[model samples]
Target: MIKIADITNIEERKAIENIIRNYREDSGTVISLLQDIQGHYNYLPAYILQLLSRELKIPLSKIYSVATFYAQFSFNEKGKHIITVCDGTACHVKGGPLLYDYLINQLGIHGGETTPDKIFSIEIVRCLGCCAISPVMIVDDELYGNLNMQKISKILSKIRKEEMIQEGSK
Candidate 1:
């Protein structure tokens, strides 16, 4: 039997083991277990999912079926930083689509596409629940509301510069 360490790093393997330990008694918690895994890894890695399938005695087909049913779950790897642009009705009225277009042009990436350097990812969501803060851009956990293209440019530029500094130091 292939061990989890054969597919993932020691830290990742440990995380998977811990997650399994939490759900081992209840086989019905597959969704919860997968959700926890996604939280740690950002996206659902194929190998990790296969490892999960074997660990839980669940068929790969069934695991994939559940994973496919949820749009929030992703199989592709995500960038270190996530940039979400809201395009809901309120945000749209406030130029959400225009902002999204600007970002797509500036970053050379659209929804679901990460930058080549894996520094940033751009995503479009229907709503962000803050109508007053319409036309919002979220970078990781920080939110910037009522954003103009200029503000967006500055924000991204600052992040890029910071990343460059860190890379140089490394």
Candidate 2:
């Protein structure tokens, strides 16, 4: 476990301190502070949270409660790409489950799991407000609807090719 005192990244510590200072006066800014921290680190680092608790003089329990209560806040690191499958009533009736299974099988990851390479993370959401486009899967911000196995394969292939090209360029 990383302790607050052991946070050696001077710039990161400064950034956290700055965030705390910026929101210190506003008692209701806890959520916004946490959101900024999460945006910086992708997930809340335990050491940073400890630092925040000390700097802001807020109880760790309260901070933790707020973090866990919000579905958007995540403790675990996420993959570079987030794939959300809609499992709403409309989507489910239109073969959302099948698409989810196909994704799991193809990616070799269960729901709520990131691929080993960190290329993709699979998640299921209740709704995406696109009932007309039921059975939808969103990769990053791009949405795919009316999908079949072949369309899924093509999409995956295209993404993989793009990634490979990007990696090669890098």
User: Best by lDDT, which number?
Assistant: 1
Query: Which lDDT values do the candidates have, in the order given?
Result: 0.85, 0.83
- Residue-level lDDT of model 2, residues 40-91, one tens digit each, is 8777877778777876778999899999999999887777778888889999
- In the order shown, the candidates' Cα RMSDs to the true structure are 2.8, 2.9
Predicted candidate 1 versus true structure: per-residue lDDT over 1-170, tens digit per residue: 56676745778778888887887866546688779988998889887788888888889999899999988888887887899888889999888878888899998999989988888888888888887987897999999998999999999899999999999999
Model 2 spans with C-alpha error above 4 angstroms? 1-5, 8-18, 24-28, 165-170
